[model samples]
Target: MQGFQQSVDIQSLISPLDWVVFAFTIALTAASVLYGNSLKKKTTNEKDNFLDLLLMGRKLTLPLFVSTLVATWYGGIFGVTEIAFNNGIYNFITQGAFWYVAYLIFAFFIIHKIKSYQAVTLPDLIGKMFGPNSAKLSALFNLFNVLPIAYTISLGLFLQTLFGGELLFNMSIGLIFVVLYSMWGGLRSVVFSDIIQFFVMCLGVFLVFSTSISTFGGLDFLKANLPTTHFEPLGGHGLATTLVWGLIALSTLVDPNFYQRCFAAESEKTAKKGIIISTGIWFLFDICTTFGAMYARAVLPEAESSTAYLTYAVQLLPDGLRGLFLAGILATILSTLDSYLFLAGTTITFDLLPIKWREKVSIHHLGVLSTAFISLILAYHFDGNIKLVWKTLGSYSAACLLLPVLFGYLFPGKISDKQFLFSSILGIVFTTYWRNAPLPGFYAQIDELYAGIVATSMGLIICRTLANFRSN
Candidate 1:
């Protein structure tokens, strides 16, 4: 729970060789962006240009799809480490197992239906299913959901740890670097950069885990050194609290990044297979990260939980390998940050903008700039509490959109536009009230997301039943 600005001299722990490796990774990422930018020229048709910018011309192959999807989804790497440091294997269960289940659900039940809509964005699909008003409302929420605040904070923290400067200044520099590369090549650049980052991140965590095993032994070392609760499934948290994480994992069902990648995939089969393959990779990566953080916990029990894994890795690894690990962590965060920034910009340009205005000007760059500014502001406001950012934003998206979007697809035409809109509004109201208002005893124990989802469900049933009664 310690802030990201740790007092430890983290910069001194990093050697020159490590810096060389890190710089090399950044250089490679820049090269990839330049290559991606060179892949296509602007066409006469605005729609085609938009498609190329936003969806990579809907030509994402299986390998690209898997790498991009995996990398983008795991951007909050520091937050994952923080959870594992505090809660042990429960981190995998809450963050990993639940999300894997959600991924399977999306691949099997949702992707094909979404493809049938031929929508450019999640909000576009919402508009198609419900109405423009519904789409606009969903876009408003989606904008908030994809703010990149958490990843921005993670990047800022990483930079601060490396260069020893103001957190805000480091954050700004990192944001600018990503925007410079991402704005030109669009998702194509993001995808290509992600392919390199995907490998680096995997290797980084694997190196940490393997190094820990060699130095400190394995599970026996962890059990002997750490508290008994750390070995427990729930890590001593209450059942309700544990289950809420599972509910939060359901946010994956409504995640814009997943939707965007699926839309970008060359075919429905590619999308489905990509997710399945990515899940297996994610499972293995989770094992490395979760156990790696636990090793940190065991060795550095008194270190800052927010950064114990980083601290341990730098101190433990040899000079050159240490640099590579740091680069991997940076890659993990940058990959997610750029993708969300792009998505937020796309949402503004393609989904939120008035049609006439969009037709009159190519303001996608403006949208990206606007999103970067807003995300920087939010990242500053939240400081370094990545978990809070995730929980708060994930709760709103899951509570408001999950049921409506999923059920709207499953039982199309069964719910009217008015019903969808009202249900979503009800979810927002209930979530807001639950989060902000003082709740009476039993209600206080319930998560705001639970309240929001229940309210939305009730609204849907009431509206549908009333319409059916009137028809009869």
Candidate 2:
């Protein structure tokens, strides 16, 4: 099938009033970053400075944790909307419901344990529990996972849709902007910016959603116009595709953004409570976005799949409101971009680097710059296939790292260094191989997550069994 092409009237999408609102939103976001930097306290030692810069001095409260977590976690606004446009309520089940379950699971069973460790980065936790080798290997995977490539693509798409330009130019400018603010104050900047973005995003979506529903009725309208399959929970993709979404959701267990917030929280209780609260906010936000998507599909059935949400909102909302909605979409993307850029930098400057070197010098800004450039390249190469980019990366990370990381935390000493290392490497190999070249015939139906997870689990089991047998 041909990729979706933009057919919406770009000239009429925004008014001068909307431009002011959109510009104000951008200004507010940048101002918040500068303000965050000013809030940075003087630190006597390098360790204190590093922590203060990267983790907000490990003093995140419930509000800050929840806002930043919610803002950073949902960067794929267009992708989410695309699913909703295509599958209707199925978007709710796959993108919203399954993830809520994961969030709840993480909050209740895992948040306390994560916070108790007080580790700054996931690789640090991995190193402490496993070994240096395991830490470095995992850091490699984590860094690749946290790269802002997909979000950069989102920003590029946003800019292209709004300003009408070459993808490369929009992506470069967007990457530069994201890198500048991210490098300015690190995670402090990210969280502070997220605070403003969270509200803007909420307002933007709320306005568009309210307008859409007011213009077109509600569930009754959807049911009358949409196919019966649209009302189906699975959204007509069948069970296998839905299961893949669940596997993708499993990445939350090892998501660096989640762990970073957990480490940054003031107490274990804050982390748990913040996560629980964020899940609720996510649910509300999903309602707004999914509702908007259905309206978009109903109103403009032939519009570009990637830009349908924004195009429909722009078509329906007034000039200023259209601008605000665009701002919200931009904020959603920037929030995620800044967070991932910072985390990717930390992986380079803090996680992968030797402790002695990292303690003495901070190259986090360099790391941020580097990540933005690399992301720009990936975003360019994977310009049209943003969903594919997310799936490939998400599936690989979840399949390869999820079990080893989770087992490392839950079972602790039960998993040996050798077993963890073997399993993790095998998992990566299996995932990469499966993604690139699957087994022939009947085995081809099984995807990367299943193949990688099963291969890694079986390897770990066999190794442990052999070790036990030898000892006995």
Candidate 3:
């Protein structure tokens, strides 16, 4: 009787119009990928086809660049809302603002250098500057870096919330669509789908924001309902916690999705301008989501905290708009899911395996399958806590690889090969130890992120100082 009652409630939340919009959004995404594939010419050269498939033939304009980049960057949409619902506007300040600074840094300093390299992958560029061994090592960590599970879990939870089902049942079905679109068109397909997704996402969020403000009162209502810490920039968290988030933001410098888009841009100027423009759009979207989540909490305080945004959205929005909003959530996840799956494949075929770029085409497809399986396993492992799923993966990558990748680009040969190797290895080792089994004392107080940063930095300093002394 209880189970039947739950199903009845779920059915009430979605109407016939909502189903039409949801199905249409998905069908349109599939059509877009098929349309992209049809653009390939019979006589296209292998070299040209390779470039076309992976990097969109290095011809992304400013608008395409902005849409794909922004859409892909925020895959953990439900997670963002979860934070906002619980913590208030601080979600925007930490998750959105910290990342904005990192994006600007990448734009001003890194994008030009990356585009100038003409490298297909971050490991390829690292191999050129550091060494093949360094590239291979970075690839191992990059595999951990781009796991698609966080977004997969987000998609799964969204489905389970909207339709009501076991978590794994929804996730398994979600993975099929993700792998299908990703495998069909590669990056071109991903970008094309992103163009559709970007608009849907923006429209859905805006409708909810507008409706919420109109129906539920505005800032005054939020101010009265939310706790003071909700508006606090730091959210009562200390410097250490905030700084850890900043460090995670710094991981953007090493993010392959950013590298792929920058590499795909028609020119350095386009990449630069695109990132700047995208940042503004992200800021606006952040306002909508952050406020929307706050409204959800205010209106539905007793709702399941994980699905608060969707719950309030459905309750507040009209029939068609409810479906559109859910589609936006799926769009947000699918865009990132496909990008990460592809990049993870690149790590396997292009980075880990020593095959010529032109000859290793099939390997990429195989790698995609491998990534999907691994991501599914990880999704199950971390499904218990959605927030920790992303944090754990982000911490591991940021702690171990962020510094070496940054120095490789910025400082180049200033750090010797031996130093670079030790730094990266020690960073991984210290991070694992800090996370799992640090000595109980002052050491226990140090987070894995800080420990990894200190260990890696020490390796570089020691090597450089010894070299200087010996030269003198």
Among all candidates shown, the one with the greatest TM-score: 1
Q: lDDT of each structure?
A: 0.89, 0.83, 0.83
Residues 389-464, candidate 1, lDDT per residue (tens digit)?
9999989998988888878888988877788899999999999999999989999989999999899899888988
- Which stretches of candidate 3 lie above 4 Å from their native place? 1-8, 356-358, 438-442
Which regions of candidate 2 are displaced past 4 Å? 1-6, 360-362
lDDT string, candidate 2, 173-268, tens digits: 988877777776678989999998999998988998888678778888778767787779987776987888898898998888888988898888
Error of 1 at 157 (Å): 0.7
lDDT of 3 by residue, 135-224 (tens): 888788888889888887988887787668898888888888788768766788999899889989988888889998998789899888
> Model 2 — which ten-residue stretch has the worst lDDT?
1-10
